[model samples]
Target: MTAIFRTERLTLVFLVLTITAICGLPLLLLFKIGLTAEGSLNIAPLLEALQSRSVLRALWHSLESSALSALFATILGTALALVIGLTNVRAKGLLVFLILLPMMIPPHVTAIAWIQALGPASPVLRWLSIAPELGSDHPLYSREGLVLLLTLQHSPLVFLLVRAALRSFPRELSDAARVSGSGATRMLVKITLPLLSPALMAGFALAFVAALGNFGINALIGIPARYTTLPVLVWRRLASFGPDVLPNVAIISVILALVALVAIVIQTVLQKRMRSALVGLPQAPLDIALGKHRLPVEALLWLFVASVLLLPAASLLATSLVKTYGLDLSLETLTLSNFAEVLWRQSVTLRAFANSTGIATLAALVIAGLSILLGYFLVSRKAGQRLMAGIAGSQAEIAFAVPGLVMSIAFILAFIRPLPIVNISLYGTLWIILIAYVSCFVAVGLKPVVAAFLQMDMSLEDAARVSGAGFGRRIRKIFAPLVAPAAASGGILVFLTAYNEVTVSALLWSTGNETIGTTIFNYEDGGYTTLAAAMSVVVVLATIVIMVAMNALTKKVPAGTIPWRS
Candidate 1:
């Protein structure tokens, strides 16, 4: 009994510290900065700086862009969900994959690809003879362009959420409405739209938070256009030379965090309502026939798929192979020189690849183990369960709202100073970056495991306990085997996200440590488009291979062995 209690206590302590270090420490640093004095550890000046005019303007711009992007994504995403989910669509699986492709490619990569496709010397525009001037005259760098890119990239998230809701929809209600002589448009507007409202709101809230926190797209598009969103402004403040700049930056980050908290609260409320309303509703499978419009509908769907999925990727491939942007494609021009340059000519790219892979892999392993333990504790343990739930829930909400840049800044503020007791320096180390990745992505790892845990029958564990099986033994024998698939799914998600992540990685990067994201950024900045494209291709290929491997491993597991199957 003493041994079991000691083991449980030790596990709890480790988890608590890990959670605090990753999530709480950064926030504490931000608070310290906010309350501290200018040029010293004092708080009054920080409050005064919060009310500055430039800060207010930046906040307003951030809000405007976020709201616009969210609104656009919601409407467009709902339309896409209706088309794919409510209707009988041939090649539904392929269409769904197409929609998810944008997520697989990092946001920075998407921005760069878009710039290549829409630039003056781009092959598509040059071929059409509609190329505009390459500089300020082009509208691609404006707020409108940022909104467009964000909408395109993030709408898929809304689409997936709404589509899932729609898939579980009660088709009988729609059938009854049709029997009552309701017209297509009227039925959609009156019945379908109302039922989907909660989901729509939740999706919009998520999109809004994501847009508010987005740094990559804003940096690529908005910064050039002189549009200073909050994240960009925060970076600028951090990079600028001034004795008082650090505190001001901290103040701004706190404000952004507050806004994110509000957005999360609203999203939580909406999701709860959605779930409640959907309860007890019979989910009949929908198979809406296109009838006479099938051919045209299929054509439009294919066109959308091609435009969104294939065109940009194809453009990237072409640009990577060609000698120059506008050069015509030929056997002579298409060589592997760019790839060679990226891999061999520049040692930084290769080093960054190694750093990124190592850090991401380590972070994924740590976070996966933590998530599984957390899930187990929440499901099985009696003591501290409410605290555990609260902590896990808060982490998820904050992870969604706090942009990578904000978190990085918070980490710098928190850990740069000397903490003699700990006897360690966090800045510039791979450990710091790993911790940042784990903090930002731990929630992602937790969600799938928690879902799997919830579906599991506790009776198995109860039986084990009744048989006098200790906690560790029961977990090793029963829970671990049952939850392996979910853990793999979560770990793979964490690995992929950390692998392609750029926003936080960019902020925390140093000369000693670079990730693939920063490497691509450097190449793009140096006007090495071919090299950047090659690196981008490498990222995409690596992601696909990892996903394939994970899928195969999951396949080998026996059915119902994993809680996901149940």
Candidate 2:
């Protein structure tokens, strides 16, 4: 008993220290540096940054693009959720999966795919004889184009949230409305929309924050368009001026972080108020009979899905097969050399693939292990255990809620200096990127385990305890087995998310530590369009394969453990 108690206390301390070091300390250091000058409290730098024309311009651009993109995404996502979630759509599972597919794909890959799809030399467009003339500006290289891609990238996020909300919608009220002779259109407009307002607001806020911190689309498209947003501005500043301008960059990051935090708070308040205004007994969601309109609606939905998914994919594949950019796809022009170059010839590509695979694997395993331990305390009856869990959970949530770029900046500030006791720098090493991945995705990996723990029967643990099993013994022998599937699912989720993600690793990657995402981005940025296309095609296929594997585990884990599956 004494040993068990000592072990528990030590575990609690370790959890607290680990989470604080990786998640809490970085953001705290970021705020400290942003709000102070030479270790003294000062707002002068922040004020000057706000007053700078370039900073102000970037800020406005960020807000404008985010707002517009979010607004459009909310409309699109909500519409899809309503049609698919409520009505009897054909292949409902497939539709939901496709809708969520874009969200799973890294934004930079989406950007690259879309860039190829719409460029002057777009194979699809050219084959259709609608390609823009050579030397014409690519249509997507402007503020509007940035918003369009951002909208497409984030709409799936909104779709997921709204669809979940729809699943919990009160069917009894809708039935009553129908019994009262309310038409579908009128009831949908009056009752359903009113009740779904909270979700709509929540979706908009989520989309807004996502767009505000978006780096890939903003950088890839906006740079050529000369439309600078805060995230891009920070990257450009740091990349161009080096760490000598860390203070200015930190201030800009703080601004971006504050905006994201404010959006979250606003969403929470609005969702709560709207939720409080309505009350209903839980029931199955509505399944309205579309009757004659069903076929056309399904056709429209499929058309929309194909336009978004297939067009870019076809363009990407076509681009990769071509021998060079700006060449039409033909028997003479089509070649496998681009894929060969990226897959085998380019040493950087091979190294990046290995680095990303290794880092993502390690991060996944570490997060999965931590999730199991932390999730146990999250559901523990003891106050001390729960307290530790709460602290760790809140930090993870805040880390995840902010933009990845913001988190990257926080990490930069936190790790640029050597550790206190170890006296070693992690700033330019892959270690920093790995640590950042664990911190950023902790919430992602913990969620499923927490869900599993919530659903678990406590009798097993009680029986183990009655048998004189220690806490560690009980967890290892009993709880661990029960939640292994959920933990695995969570780990897979983390791997998929971090595998090709550029945001968190964008600033952290050094010469030898190039991640797959950074490598692809570099290829595209450096005018190696065919090479980028080939790598992106590979990434997309790999992502689909992993997602399919997770999909196979749908029956083993909790219902919502797999987002696309649920």
Candidate 3:
């Protein structure tokens, strides 16, 4: 009995520390940096900056773009979900995979692809004369363009969430509605829409949050348009540090936190209403027939899938091979020189690639291990469950709103000044980068692990204990293998997120500490379009390979062992 209690306590402690490191430390650092010797935090300087007409204009511009994009994306995504979930769409498995492809590729990669496809010298643009005059800038580098790009990148998230809601829908209610002689459109607008209200609201909130916090798209397009969102503004401010730096950062952080909090509250209320509506209804399987309209619906679906997934990718591939962008596309003009220059001619690009992969891999491993242990504690241990639950539940909302650039700035302020006392300088070190990556991404890793843990049967662990198996032994023999796939899934996702991460890395990266993302940014800024494209291709290929390998390994594990299914 004493041994079991000790084991539980140990697990709880581990989880507390992990939460502190990932979530608490950054906020604490923010306060430490902004407060005076008397312990009073100041926001006057930051508020003054915010009061500027230009700053207010920029903020309004960002909010308007984000709101519009979210609204449009929610509608499109809801329509897609309805089509896929209600109708008999053939090759759904293939369609689902294609729909998810855009998410796998980074936003910067998508931007580059768009430029290549729509630029003045491209074959399609040449035919359409969409290219600008000699002194005109490209259309892809504007506020409207940014909205289109972000909408394309983030709409799939809405689709996935709403589709899940549709799948789990109670069909009896719909059947009752149909038997009442209601028209299809009326039933959809009244019954279906009301039923899926929570899902729709959640989708809108997620899209808005993503758009608000987005840095890559803004950096790629908005900067050229002279439009700065909060994340971009924070980055610029941090880069131009003075005595007012800490207060300015604190103000931005508070604004971001408030936005995130509002979204979370709205989501919670809607979700609770949805749950109440769903209570007492037996979940029935859903299969809506297309009833002779399948072909046309499928054609439209395929058009959307192709436009969102294949066009950008194909454009990037074509651009990478061409000797000069905007030149006429000819087989004779294709060369391997761009690839060579990125991979061989530039040592920094190659080194950054390796460094990013290695650091991300390590971070993933650490996150996976920590999350599993934490999940077990939360599920099996009783004493600290409430605390753990509170922390874990809020992790997603907090992480979603905490812009990567802001977190990096908080980290620098927290660590840079205090390191000398510890006889160590952490700034610009790989350890600092790793710490930042892990902290920024741990919430993503935790969600899957916690879900997997909840699905696991307590009986298995109980039996092990009854048979005299020790805590560590039971975990090693039963829990570890069962949860390995889920952990691996989380790890792979984290690795990909960290590897391709540009915003956080851009803030924290220093001389002699470049990541592939930063390297790509540098090449683009230096007007090395071919090299940037080449580097992007390499990163994409490597990411695809890693994803494939992780999926294969995950498949060999048991069905309920994976996070998504669980």
Candidate 4:
């Protein structure tokens, strides 16, 4: 019986139940509330919710903005990927790194930086003598701003996906085309574009989902523009009505979830087609010489990168240094008081930093440890491996695919009451947020581990079992060391993602439990732009330092563990 307790069936059951609880219960609760009212079947509520003017507008806004943003980002990102990926550009590695930096910065931070970079008091705009009129609303506080900022924030995701697909591209196809006297442009259009279509579709779908779920740009720009998306609508309902708005929030969440589901399905289909189309050894990138056009193209690419990367950074740095956001930088006006105020002087800021670090760290460690067990069970060659994998994978995918605002609402709906055993409420506390992060990021942490397990040699574990070692012994002594590197990498990913997470914590955080992301958002909403900039600078700098440290350690880990490595 003791041995049976640790059998494979037990492991599988435990994994399935954990996944269901984390992702399933919240989702189930959401649909139930949305599709029911007063313990009776009620399509009227859903129909009424859908028909409401605000809801209709939000739906249109979400769909319209996400579609446009995805289109723009896909075009720009695909172009950049083709140019840098295939061309014999100098410093290609560094250029790719810079292009990807925007993805690392949280969306809210990017919004804040851009707002500061182009507002009425912008140093850049002022220097160009095109700053908006004083006391005028921010030029970026509109629907157009949401579209632009969302595109910029999500373009890197498209770039990464498209570039990865291109890395596996067969050079022979292009070579054969070249033999037919196909020029560079002709080769690109004739051979490369056809093979890259699936990837392009996949990239566009990724960007669409990202933009649809984006809360930062919407919160900062959409609210001011009276442009409400589903994500922003969810946040507003919760803020304005709290828990009493659960039914309405659930209906909104269902709509958001449906949109996310459609995007994921599209992306998954395209990815399958992409994989089926390409199966061969990856070769050197097809080097296309730009000839006389080389310098101009390179300069153009750098200029775009600078606009997205450098301008926002310069804005944040300047804002943090100045006495106030509107003040010009000079020997007389320049000061670091905002930095001091946010970094050390304010108890809220200090507590936010500590709380965010603690919560993110806890979530990372818990997910890492669980991922080993989950990954092992997922990859086991058992009778029901495929079924188990499908169930677990879908749950993880759905949890991550939905917007943070929607997920936060689900958490509130599911956990607002006291626990069954302890009889203690988890709502209105950091514990709820912690639980949400675990559910939200479990997929991220498990990805590398599952990959690692797929490639691991099972002979060592088989030998350990033959030596009478139990599941605990084998895992602790054998699999632990083998899977540690992948687990560690995934943990870092979860930590980085959850640290500056604003959308999930926006509604979940309270006065004493503010996260770094929510703190920055709060400062901005309170008209403390400089203070917001200071905190954002801190978050971005820390994120970069962590990424650098990871880069240094990537060489030691197994290949293919890091997404950016390939």
- Candidate 1, residues 1-566, lDDT tens digits: the string is 77876786677667767787678878777867776655567656655756788878878888988899999999888987788776787887667666766766788788778877777656666656776765535557888998988888888878877877776777777888889999778988988888888889888988888888887788777777888888888877766653257767778887788788788788788767765454457575466788889789889988877887666677677788888765645687788888888788788888898899999989889877887788887665576754765575576447546878778878787767765798788777777788899889988877777777888888998798789888788778998887777777778778898999888877678887989987887677678887888898888888767755655555534332221121
Query: Which ranges of candidate 1 are over 4 A from the true structure?
Result: 35-53, 133-136, 242-244, 269-276, 279-284, 381-383, 548-550, 553-566
lDDT: worst 10-residue window of model 2 = 276-285
lDDT of 3: 0.74
Q: Which regions of candidate 4 are displaced past 4 Å?
A: 1-7, 38-41, 269-276, 558-560
Ranking by lDDT: 2, 4, 1, 3
Assess candidate 1 and give its TM-score to the true structure: 0.91
lDDT of 3 by residue, 387-452 (tens): 675575465337545667667777677667546567787777777888888788887777677777
Candidate 4 structure lDDT? 0.86
* Tens-digit lDDT string for candidate 2 (13-87): 898789989999999999999998778999988889899999999999999999999999999999999998888
lDDT assessment of candidate 2: 0.92
Best by lDDT: 2
Q: Mind giving the per-residue lDDT tens digits that candidate 4 earns over 1-566? A: 37734575677777788889988889888888888778877778778888899998999999999999999999988998999889987778778878888887899999999988988888767767888998999888888888999999888888888888788887787888889898888988877888888888888988998899888888899988889999988888888888888888888888888888878887877667665455567798788887898899889988988888888788888888888778877789888899889988999999999999999999999999888988887777664855786687779878987888888888888888998998999888889999999999999899888888888887877787678888777778888788898999999989999997898888889889889999999899899988998899989999988877778657655665665665
Off by over 4 Å in 3: 31-37, 127-134, 240-247, 273-275, 279-285, 381-383, 392-397, 418-421, 549-566
Question: The CA-based lDDT of model 1 is what?
Answer: 0.77
| Lowest summed lDDT window (length 10), candidate 4 | 1-10
